[model samples]
Target: MRAVRYHEGGDPDVLDLEDIERPDPGRGDVLVEIEAASVNPVDAKFRAAGLPRLPKTTGSDLAGTVVAVGEGVDDYAEGDRVFATGLHTGRFAGGSFAEYAAVPTDLLAHLPEGVSFEHGAAVALVGVTAWRALVHHAGLEPGGTALVHGGNGGVGHVAVGLADALGATPVATARPQYHDALGDLGAGTVLDYGRDDLADAARDATGGADAVLDHMPDTYLGTDVAAAGFGGDIVAIAGDTATFPDVAAARSAELDVHMMSMSNLATHSDAPDIGPILDRIGNLLAEGRLDVTIDRTYGLDEAAEAHRAVLEESFLGKLVVEP
Candidate 1:
């Protein structure tokens, strides 16, 4: 099997395409022949910082077909087409960036009838993160207002669509060029993030955003704190470092701020069964209610190039690497 792995993490250049023996599924696992894998920002971060295993396959999202099943696996069988996040029970078994992977059945999700491999891969990680942030942390409900920083962005775009699907009106910020895209996804109004007074603009757009999904925590954590309506929720879905929030504003508004990590759900033993949520997301994709944007595609051999592109380019959506 041909896979992209890094002996020691440093940068995009660290990722190399190599020939390795294919892995067999262990107990309660499924060996999926990779069709497409999606790269998220975390993949780059993990690549640069080193991983739990040396020479690790770093992709976390995949859309593929089950070619073999290990013991205790019955939900799926040979040739069952599926898409899944490989980080289950917080353990890393080579990510999806390869020709094949042994994924636990608990992490598997059925790909809907009409969704393509690329779209399925694109939605894997970001989709679940957005679903957890809006549906759980934000406690967002229809007829409410959602303020999404970077609304047309990777996770932000999904937040917009899911919030709308959940019946809330989402207001997101984006570069002027992406305003229409956000608007099309049911953003009440897409603010120009270039301006500094976003809190004020968001206020005017919907009187005040009821909930905030902060994608750009470095830039918008304080802003989200300031804009959230009294007693509103603000969920931070990204950011690796500790962020300082406006204590005064938070105290004044009595805002409920929380941090969301999909990784915890993927790895934590106490995490809820994601299969149900994933199934719901699949249904939405099948029904065209949930939206996904596949911004770019690369071949397995071009994995290094794909990593570089993710870092250098301002992609409109998810990036997929096919094997």
Candidate 2:
């Protein structure tokens, strides 16, 4: 089997494609013949910081067919088409940037018919994150207003559609070039994040946003606080050291703030079951209610270039790797 691995990560250049012995599935696992994997910002971050173990593979999202199943994996069998975010194992055994991956049953879901392998891999992690932020943490309700920062990025784009699907009016912030596209994806209002009047425009859209989905809380925390309605929910998915610029304002408004990461749920023992969420996402994809835009596709050998594009480029949607 061939895989992209980094022995001691420092940059994208550290990724190398090499031939390695194929892995066998362990108990409650299934061996997937990987067809497509998507590059994420986390992949590049981990590549730069280096993993605790040497020579770890570089991707987490994957879609493929099951070639074999291990003991206790009775729900899935040979030839089952599956897609999953594979970072839960914590040992890198489920890395998808390879010809095959051994994924646990708990993290795996049956890919709905008519969903392409590329779309499946592209949406796994980002889709799940957006769904959790808006539907679970934010408690977005029908007819409410949602303010989404970074509305043209991977998770932002999906959040726009999901907010609309849930009957909420979506007010998104993006570059001017993406305004029309965001509107097409169900955003009722799109504002330029660079504009000085961004918060004003957001507030004017719905009096104030009922919920704010923030991707770069480090830079947008104040904007989120200024644009949200009284007692609104603000969910921050990024920014490790994110802080409120005006704690008094947030407190006075009685805003609810939350910080989350998909990796935390993947690794935590007490995390809620994600199987139901994946099933809902798959249903939406199958029914054409949700879409994942593919900005580009790369070969497995060009994984390094894919990593570079994910971090250094401003492409919309996801970059996929077909093995």
Candidate 3:
């Protein structure tokens, strides 16, 4: 298997294309012949900030056919198409950037009949992230309102789609060029962060959202705070922040900040029972109720190029690498 790996965390240039031994499935594991994998910010983060352990393979989300199932695995079989995301487990654990990967059966989901390999690969990471934020953390309600930052981003787009399907009005922030795309994705109003003020824009759009789903919470905390309706919640899926805007001052107007890391079994509740979420999203894809957008596609060998594209913020949606 050819994998893009690095001995140390640094710039994207550090990624080296090399042939490595294919991973073998262990008990309760499934060996997938990867057809496509998606590049995410975490892929780059793990490269630039991976553990001291050298020679780490970087990739989380993958879509492929099951070529083999290990001992104790009875739920899946050879030739089954599957979608998966890495759980940050073992060394060489996340070798999805290559032709094969051995993933735990618990992290795997069946790809819907109509969902293409690329779409399956693209949806898992972001879908799970959005589901955790909207359904698990904030408990977003039907007929509620959510203000989403980076509405054009991979996770943000999925959040908008799910929020709409769940009967919430979504207001999103993006660049002017992506405004129409957000609207088409079911965002009731699109605010251009580069051109408009988010707080005022969100307030005017949905009369203040019941919750705010933010990617860069540190950068937009104040705006999200101002845009939230009294007692509304704020969920941050990405970013590292100790505290948000002052809460004591907003008495009777609660502004609680929730982080997606809470979804990790190590920190918060046990890993959610995602079987139902995947089934629902699978139906949405099968019926065209949801759209998985691929901004660009690269061949497996060009994994470094894919990382560079994402690091440079050039792609519009999920960036995929076909093996």
Global fold similarity of model 2 (TM-score): 0.97
Which has the higher lDDT value, candidate number 1 or candidate number 3? Answer: 1
For model 2, residues 30-82, the per-residue Cα lDDT tens digits are: 99999999988988888898864567888978999999999988899999998
**TM-scores of all predicted structures:** 0.95, 0.97, 0.93
Ranking by lDDT: 2, 1, 3
Candidate 1 per-residue C-alpha lDDT over 1-323 given as tens digits, one digit per residue, 9 for 90 to 100:
98888999797888888889999999988999989998887788778888657778878888889999999988989988888874522665577889999988878788877898888888888888888888878888879899988876678898899898899888888889888877888788899988878888887775667789887687788788777888888898777664777788788888888887888877678876566777888888899988888877899888888877776777577888899
For TM-score, candidate 1 versus 2, the one ahead is: 2
Candidate 3 per-residue lDDT, tens place, 182-287, comes to: 8898999888887556678787887867888988877888787788888788898777874657666345577667877523631223566544566667778878
Model 3, position 304: C-alpha lDDT score = 79
Error of 2 at 90 (Å): 2.5
Q: Which should have the higher lDDT, number 2 or number 3? A: 2
Question: What is the Cα-based TM-score of model 3?
Answer: 0.93
Q: What is the C-alpha RMSD of each candidate to the true structure, in Å?
A: 1.6, 1.3, 2.2
lDDT of 2: 0.87
Off by over 4 Å in 1: 86-89, 240-243
Indicate which candidate wins on TM-score: 2
Report the C-alpha displacement of residue 320, candidate 2, in angstroms. Answer: 0.8
